[model samples]
Target: MNRREFVRWSGLGMMSLLLSGCGILGTSAGAAGEEVQKNSVSGGNKMKIVVINSSPHARDESTSIYLSDRFSAGAVSAGHQVFTFDGANEETHPCRGCDICHMNGPCVFSDAIENKLMPELLSADMIVLVTPLYYYGMSAQLKTVIDRFYSRTGMLHGKKSMLIATAYDSADWTMTALSEHYATLVRYMDWVDVGQVLGIGCGSRSLVEKSSFGEQAYNIGANL
Candidate 1:
């Protein structure tokens, strides 16, 4: 199936099942299952993770997209109940800064995040954002979503979050812009930091494929 079709269907499925399971199967069943398997517990303290991939490139083989996919696979292997969203798709509309979310309780765009993402967040124990560097910062697409997340206010409070970025520059300071950006959110929501992966020297997909750090990044995802 096409990427658009896949995300559209996945969003719909997530919404339907997330709501249904609340009454019939009980909330946190999926998250609980992961906890039992990963933590050696039966019913307590499960962690739900929602990973958002913020690369605007369309191809499945883009550096950031592949990294995000690998991370998702690793998260599943680590026994975490994970949900993934491709921020590259246009289905996720840019936040217009209209402040409609203040009264609407979600982004006024209402396509990907409002209907699908909020439920995942409500059900998740943690969040992971994976993106590529765009002008020394997160891709413009991701910045938009991050801004929209402001509407969530205290909803994500106390939850764990991590940032993963792949860039062409090897300098540590290359990620400073995103670090500053996420720092504000961390301060705003009072979230705990699980980890952050800054993969440098990776502007092209070939570079990402050739880089040794890609494997390390994948391991980070698998272990987290």
Candidate 2:
């Protein structure tokens, strides 16, 4: 059975607004405006999808972007809404391990995750995390935002989710930590696991451009 054994489908910046594909981009228009990311694709059914891109590299050199672009392109083509955020570029700080949020209020800080992503994430039907594997785990940038999920964490439950990760090493264990972390998140949050596209051995941008990883990403998006 394929990861897409079932079908259903599903950014960041000023939430680089809009999912563009099949000629009908919703036009979130990268308010912060960086280019080369076209994850939108051709399909049907409308879902509000949020993409968190956590690669700190330049768009041209980031293998993670190479895969995320194709995945989202297929999604946009399939008629879902996409909001993308570059967590790495945004001014988001690490969690303070505070429990004020547990007191039924918002977080202590008004940083990027709070100011920008929280609303979109709260209402989003699905969430797609795009990142480059870092030290056997997810990028610290992405983790900081997730840790802030301490605030209103329960509101994020019961949504669909996916992960797209790129790594240079092709070892059998290359993605284990990240994969397990993602698995633990969905299980704990009661989220539906849409699927994951782990681009193993995808080190350089040039290599990723020619790899089937991009195609796999596109297929996942198209199906969703």
Candidate 3:
């Protein structure tokens, strides 16, 4: 079926937010001192976006954080509200796949999601995951959060989402695995896929700062 038909059959409430391209939703103002815009699809358009920076590296070195900052700034510039959580600073433990969360609710670990992340997520119109590559795959830090997401019991369904990833090399390969992981959730949650920002060919912090890719990231934010 076509996209619209698929959305209609999904049984999700009237596609609340854009639900793609970073998966931010709702009608909220951007960051302070920013302008809001009318939605092209609907007359009313304000986005409440929550950003999760899942990079294991420091926020300064996190390409995911850096790129997301650009997008967040862009959202603000366009009059959208953005909230962010850095997994690096969060104290979540790894998922044991014990299926306890599946039986219960939320994860058993102590981390930002249980405290800060969930509160923001429940109120957010959209959700964005910013992560780095580890061995050509998602960082373990981000994966831990994803595992915890199952505890939501389909709460994330129909929510908007975006994934931003940075890798030193062969990053494209990681996208398949990442997409597969998200696809499973999207199928059950009725979430939509927006766009992704992939930054490849940069490893060191210095390289990222001086690289044009950084400027591209900034532009991405400026336009978001």
Candidate 4:
């Protein structure tokens, strides 16, 4: 089947069923995912959304996850199929400068990149990046994961993309670089622009929880 057709079929609940079974989440995230599955809306203009979250903190402690939880709940309530890629918990390493993937079939690293990440990315209709600003940029682990996309650049084209970011530096300038980076990736992938929730001043879990950014995130998903 064609990509559009496949995504349409996925909206029929096949992909929703796989969301919880994919083993991409830690225990806490996994339990929450079960709720998303249970509340899924059936037979509409649904989508397969892959959330790439790159936070080093544990599932319980991470502010990034907090925002993602809000976004996922909103998306599920709107009937989209959401699958989160817990980048920190997996074994995805930085792309070694082997330069082999360009001339070879795939990269040498065969852990999460091969086993989990690429599969979902290939099938996803939308890609959401949930990240904490690290020195005004994406986290190191997330950068590494993106680097590994070298092998499948062609396959990843033409998807929709969104960003959910948080930073302790409340200055508006803090998100400038990260936003530019995300814009660059969107251009590179030829992705349709979706809304973003850039949570400025969300320095900690409690801060993110208390922030209206969560509601912004929810509205993004709900309106979609």
Residue 59 displacement (Å), model 3: 2.3
RMSD per model, one decimal: 11.7, 11.1, 6.8, 10.1
Query: Please, what are the lDDT tens digits per residue for candidate 3 over residues 120-174?
Result: 8777777777778777667777777766665664566566666777777744564
- Model 1 segments more than 4 A misplaced: 1-46
Best of the two (2, 3) by TM-score: 2
The residue-by-residue lDDT of candidate 2 on 45-125, one tens digit each, is: 478899999999987889998888887897787667889988899889887866666623487888888889998999898
Q: Estimate each model's TM-score.
A: 0.73, 0.79, 0.72, 0.78
Superior candidate under lDDT, 1 versus 4: 4
User: Which segments of candidate 2 are over 4 A away from where they belong?
Assistant: 1-44
| lDDT tens readout by residue for model 4, 34-129 | 454444321235789999999989877888889988889977986789988888778887877675665223678888877788888889988888
lDDT of 4 at 196: 64
Local distance difference test, each candidate: 0.64, 0.73, 0.62, 0.73
Q: Deviation in angstroms for 141 in model 2?
A: 0.8
Q: Order the candidate numbers by lDDT, best to worst.
A: 4, 2, 1, 3
* Model 1 worst lDDT run, 10 consecutive residues: 20-29
* Best by the TM-score measure: 2
Please tell me which model should have the higher TM-score, number 1 or number 2: 2
Enumerate residue pairs that collide in model 1. Answer: none
What TM-score quantifies how close candidate 2 is to the native fold?
0.79
The segments of candidate 3 whose C-alpha lies over 4 angstroms from its true place after superposition are 1-44, 96-107, 170-174, 210-212, 215-224
Deviation (Å) of 3 in candidate 1? 37
